[model samples]
Target: MTNYDSAFRWMKVKNGRLHFASIELDIQKNDFENKIVDDYLVNGFKNDSEGIKPWKKGLIRGLEFTLSKSSNFWTIVIKELQAPVLDSNPAIIGYTAILAFIEKTKIIIDEDDLRKIELFVYESWKGSNADKVPNFNKLIFE
Candidate 1:
């Protein structure tokens, strides 16, 4: 089996949350108790969809938490998307928006991190699931 298949199969799915090592993509519920809640409330919720509403909420809340506490929030978002759970789309949306925000604001990200983000974006767009989500590539350029 491929590395992804092996790693994915080993991940624990509990309480609707995918646990990858120590990081948990808690899909069960949205925890709004975070420092960056204001940004998500003011801006992130505008992109929510009906089908994945809860997942989207959880994603935004997770982003808020990560942004407040993690130095490598971008990496966390990217890795979170690797989970083949129901909230993959939500995670994708969250990370795509984060990448677009970074690019638009000219945030000083490390070269390696930027390259990894670009690679992930390219692979995501080239995947079959690309049609199901917004055109993230266009958003990056916009």
Candidate 2:
């Protein structure tokens, strides 16, 4: 697993307003990856009054994904050829967002192990919520 601690650098929420301390992308080398991360940084943060600013979308090698916040949960929808390929269960707005995205995409290939992945997601985000944004000290990704 690789740790992406810089993923949430300079990101936070204060006084019910989402804040992005910086938008520089010196860490990621790939342009596509940088674009994806940039889009998330620019549109992902939520302001209390306006809520989430609609669906934030991205496309990776023809695979399309969208990120949106509803209530306190973040929703990720992955699509192929404009058809829904994976509609993830709602995840709390923290590491759960990344977890859901990774797991749900994995499910597209490992459909037989659905229960296990679902369980993992449920266990990861069970007691989490949006009140506290986790420090991006260590985000493990395989």
Candidate 3:
């Protein structure tokens, strides 16, 4: 099992909403949050678009994610952006989208633990709510 295996098993669900405290703590302890942010900024944004277009798009989408308390990075990417559901789990995609959102918003998360909270949310969703596997054609031709 991976380091987060037990954490995933110990997920808490309250009021039909999953809580990610355990996973968030694990990510912070392992220092994966910085890697997630740096990778998203340097690789994800650059490879996804050219020039400032990606930044502008990220800001817009980020704001949308932030303002919609009912929506999240995974839902926005899947339903709004129509991103192809691929093999990579929701945790990774949600993490990047969250970083972009955090970048565009005044939400004051700690710089060192930036991705921790988002990771928790996404991980919890993946473990407790999301389908066991991704549907590659969920947004086919969209």
TM per candidate comes to 0.31, 0.23, 0.26
Candidate 3 shows a clash count of 0
- For model 3, residues 64-115, the per-residue Cα lDDT tens digits are 4443432223222211222222322233333344454444333554554444
Error of 3 at 21 (Å): 23
Please, what are the lDDT tens digits per residue for candidate 2 over residues 38-117? 23332233222232321111122112221221112232222111111122112223233333344433324334333443
Most accurate candidate by lDDT: 1
lDDT of 1 by residue, 1-142 (tens): 1233322222334345443221222111224432322222212123334654534443453345235433332332222323244334433554444443344334455666545543443443334543344332233311
Where does model 3 exceed 4 Å of error?
A: 1-82, 88-94, 105-107, 118-128, 132-142
Runs off by more than 4 Å, candidate 1: 1-34, 38-49, 52-92, 100-108, 131-142
Which candidate should be chosen as best, given TM-score against the real structure? 1
TM-score of structure candidate 3: 0.26
Candidate 2 vs candidate 3: which has greater TM-score? 3
Q: Report how far off residue 104 is in candidate 2 (Å).
A: 12
RMSD of each: 16.7, 15.8, 14.2
Clashes (backbone N, CA, C under 3 Å), per candidate, total 0, 0, 0
Q: Which of 1 and 3 is the better model by TM-score?
A: 1
In model 2, residue pairs whose N, Cα or C atoms come closer than 3 Å (at least 3 residues apart or on different chains), thus clashing, are none
* Model 3 CA lDDT for position 108: 55
Model 2 misplaced stretches (Cα beyond 4 Å) = 1-35, 40-108, 125-142
**Best first by lDDT, ranked:** 1, 3, 2
